[model samples]
Target: MLNKILLVCLLFSAGSSLTCKWMDRDFKQYSESALALLKTMKTNSTNSIDDIEVDDAVAFPNELYKHASKESREERLSFVAHVLDEIYALFEENQTRASWPENTVDDFLDIISQQANGVRRCAGKQTTNHHKKNHRKMSLYFKRLSRHVLEHMDYSADAWEFVREEVRIHLHKVHLLASS
Candidate 1:
């Protein structure tokens, strides 16, 4: 009886593992597309600093960033910085689009820029306590900025809730991986 129970548990675990992998397949595809779009935008922004694409290019990267290994944290950090750079550039172009004052946008951008610099500084180095701290700090900054943007960007309440959930998931992943 014990052997049968152990076999059932193992099978259940394997089944759930496969189910999760299957469910993640679609999300993974979406994330890949988002990363590609962000890369193109990053390249375009490099060529013409004034012309940043206005879409939510950073959306998919959150998924990828959540799953990235500790060894690749630097690259992920740079990826995040590039995403923020794009968003900040867009803010400069679309200041009139937001209902909020220019100062509000500037405040968020300033916070993002500081976090970006911290991430850049830690890039390509062995992970340390400082790197973890930087990630945590950046995660908090990102959540704040995301909430503000979602609210001001004309998204519906449901959309804002979706974004909030995404931010929660990403921050959870960041902290979880930081400990590991």
Candidate 2:
């Protein structure tokens, strides 16, 4: 009986492991495609000074990414989902001001939404305060970025460039999380 139980457990674990690998492959493809689209958009855009002078300090939450990296797989998936959600909101809010092709923007957003859904599915419905603090910080960062882009940047090429770089960095972080 003991040997039988052990064998069954081993088989179940192996099956789940294979399932996870398949899911990861899908996640990786989504992330890669998003990154590639961003790259193409950036390349086609006019060259402008990448630096923007802002009165306030708006920074990416590196600490959040670092902490999430050390947590369990579920936690990492949750963080990526949350970040993608926030990015989607930001992009939706500012899409009107972007000079990029509308179809490209739509495709990018669609991919992001799909990727977020996949991550959330893998993360399950468990909610924890483990990432609440960093999540708030990230929310604030996007809010500030929105304000800057709308009020100050307007239709400036530099503003769009700044936005692209910030978004690219966030997507790169998501890719890293998914890869791990």
**In TM-score terms, which candidate is top?**
2
Name the regions of candidate 1 deviating beyond 4 angstroms.
Answer: 1-63, 125-180
The global C-alpha lDDT for each of the candidates, from Candidate 1 onward, is 0.44, 0.77
The numbered model that scores best in lDDT is 2
TM-score of candidate 2 versus the correct structure, residues matched by position: 0.81
Q: Please provide, for model 1 over 82-143, each residue's C-alpha lDDT reduced to its tens digit, 9 standing for 90 to 100.
A: 44454444344433332344454455456545544444443434545644554555555544
For residue 179, what is the lDDT in candidate 1? 28
Residue lDDT tens for model 2, 82-109 = 8999888877765565667878878999
- In model 2, the worst 10-residue window by lDDT is 43-52
lDDT, candidate 2, at 116: 89
State how far residue 28 of model 1 sits from its true place (Å).
28
